[model samples]
Target: MSTSYDITQDKWERFTFSREGRVLTAAITSDHPVNGVDEQMHTELALVFNCLQRDSESDIIILTAKGRAFCAGGDFDWFEEQINHPERFRAIGWDAKQIVTTLLNMEKPILCRMNGAAAGLGATIALLCDIIIADETAKIGDPHVKVGLVAGDGGALIWPQLIGFAKAKELLMTGDLLTAKEAERIGLINYAVPAAELDAKVAELVAKLQANPKWAVRWTKTTANIPLRALAAQLMDASIGWESVSNYLGDRREAVAAFKEKRAPKLTGE
Candidate 1:
């Protein structure tokens, strides 16, 4: 445990990283209203896991955001950039794959503090966490289909694993969000507590994990993540590829426009 990495020194424009004793926390600090995952935030998230994994100071990593929403979704303006300049989607597609793989492969446990609403890639990130403690006001969903893209990033793999294929398919196809309690009941998340109690609940779990044998805790996580890592290895490339292809060919422009305009999208599958 001699690895000496200081994540707080990184020039992170999209997040604020800090450590408290053995617990390192990365808080998404996007300027967007709901802390949308724009290009910068997505890139930072893709790289942060590696730092956290190597940092010996952190026994547990707590992921959260500094807004009313964990992450509402992608930055619509950025999505528009992908639609308008399809060439950029390739880089972002690779980033999407990295975000999932890096987080999954980390030996240190990650606990998601779902303090508010999470949707699209945000939902996938939260669900893929080792443990999720969500505030009751938080809602979660993978609305990629609603925005005319497949739930390809990580949702297609993890949702069915967490909740069952039937329910996963229904939710993925509809792109509907679930309340925190509903998500917990459906087995999509670990726990959902009142907003005021969210920090206390996470702190309790952190203390319990920290009090145990560190290597054993990390090894248990490593063992449990084997299956997920294998599945992700098999599916991430193809899924992210097709997601890029969909962005190149699908009715994403119309769907996004409709969303911003508050109107029905005329999707012809072009």
Candidate 2:
């Protein structure tokens, strides 16, 4: 059988296959305190997905990080670059969207092991996973609104579906960090286990999946995802457009500035 994932290194990340059959792993190493999906990370993720797709033997993917935080979301430097290059911003937005879509449509099961704090796009991807197992101590939230962006990507689409619109709206609007246990209670995550037990739990789940008929498993996932796929195809663009436009608005400008200043954001009618 072909290897699950060919090990590779980029400037700030690494990709490899787990010993378990059909499981892929990505390890990101950044000098910063937390990892951010900058342009380079986006390119690496795209390549990783393509590589995983080409390897027909692969049947499962587990995305985990190696720091105190899973991902801190966008790189400010990259964001600044996008601000300077609006065309590039649009292209990057579409590219990032493609990455999420690819994961959603992958033939194999996708499990997200949220080992640590997950925010913004990190939280978005975690929610999109077929299974989400979080470290009991982890906190997950969408801080996009805190930064003046609409909770685009999968946040607006999945949160409401998973937890109902009322709760989703409150959390997304407030940017509150939900504890893992709380996350599970709200149906935001599958399970919250001790930090040490996280990997083992994921392995157990994967084993269960691996033991099942691959075709049947894949078909079940594909069928269940059809609704999510349709929802995304229908609403993702409008949500992203709203988010992108929000970036240029006075409220978002103040939001980012407040974040930088470590102060509560004050919004004024614009």
Candidate 3:
């Protein structure tokens, strides 16, 4: 008799999980206007990966979102709260570390179904996946610096490893967005297909992974992740610390205020 791993029992307010055979799809289902990350979503993101990793029935995991954008970075309202309350931002440092470490530690293969724009932490999550198949129209980038914050939440760790340090430094420093096609060309992502073909392409890749020997595929992913895991361990705490420190900086406050006023941020670089 097969042991059942009922994913429905995994109660998550911001995420929904559904399984098709041994392949599970975990989607971000936030109701924010842009499906942005808030306090609840951030906490859930840190916890949900562990739950998915524990699901014995799922051999492959697909990370995606329900709406147009995968995740449109951090919610502005939440950003405001963090700016006003240093303790609140500092409190989430553990969750930030957990999100990166748990993801790197997972043995199962993960595929990102990039339905639309994925910026900042959203970009970090998608990039951390083992295989990323993005819609041609989708955009991906870590624009933490744009808001005067550090891209310490796995962005710094993964980008350099994926596309090399030189290009990674340029993008992270500038906080520029890249077309999915450009991402693929730069080897930052695996495939960029037409919007209409995104689902079909993801399904094809899932089938290919399922056809391989289960342990071999899982262990191969684990083996490949060893270096990444080490890097994450060394860098996550310090990066998250810097991001927290940034929340109290004048530049971050100005960035948020300018965003609300729909004007340019005159960052003093303080």
Candidate 4:
């Protein structure tokens, strides 16, 4: 008999969790126009994976969002706060590390239902998933450099692994967004299907995994993630440290200010 792990007991302000049979779907439910990550959401993102990992009732986990966009990136208000109080940004290094590490440590296979655009940390989360199925109209990218920050979250670690170092450098440096089709062409994501077919495709993949031996499937994912876990251990601290330094830079302030004022950032190479 399957033991029930009550997910509702975990109060999440920006996320909602629900399970059907043994598949738990964790969604980004922030009311932001694009579901941007704020301080609260970031904390929840770091903790949600651990919660889901402990859900013995779940065999598969689907990471998705409730709005038109999966997650557009960081909230502009939150960005400004980090820029203004660089010390506040320091505390997020642990949460940032936890987000990536816990997801990597999860034994259950994660399928990213990329319902819409995913940028910055959103893209990192999607790319780290074992399989990614995106809506054909959606876009994916790590635009951290656009806002004068290093793509140091999981972007540095996962992008290079998925699409190779040369392409990853070009995109991360330029802060370019790729259409779902282009992302698939470059092997950054698994499948780009019509929006209407997104759920059907995810269900199909879920069914295939459910048919297999449970431990065998779970252990296979754990084995496949060994190298990724090693890379995360090696790079996360330095990357997050550099990102924190960028938070204190004049360029970061200018970028956030420009975003809020609806103007181009006047960035000097400060």
- How big is the RMSD of model 4? 1.7
Greater lDDT among 3 and 4 belongs to 4
* lDDT comparison, 1 vs 4, better candidate: 4
Candidate 1 TM-score versus the reference:
0.97
lDDT of each: 0.90, 0.77, 0.92, 0.93
Model 4 agreement with the true structure over 201-229: per-residue lDDT tens digits = 99999999999999999999999999999
Q: Where does candidate 2 clash, by residue pair? A: none
Deviation of model 3 at 241, angstroms:
0.9
Q: Encode model 3's per-residue lDDT on 71-98: one tens digit a residue.
A: 9899999999999988999999999999
**Per-residue lDDT value at 186 in model 4:** 96
* Residue ranges of candidate 4 with Cα displaced over 4 Å: 1-4
Runs in model 2 deviating more than 4 A are 1-17
| Model 1: per-residue Cα lDDT over 1-270, one tens digit each | 555877787688988977788888899897799999888888988898888888766789999999899988888888899999988888777778889999999999899999999999899889889899999988999999888887898999999999999999999999998999999998999999999999999999998898899999999999999999999999999999888888876588889899989999998978
Which candidate has the highest lDDT of all?
Answer: 4
Q: Tens digit of lDDT per residue, candidate 2, span 115-201?
A: 888888888878888899999998999988877778877788889989999999999999999999999998999999999899899
Candidates in order, TM-scores: namely 0.97, 0.89, 0.97, 0.97
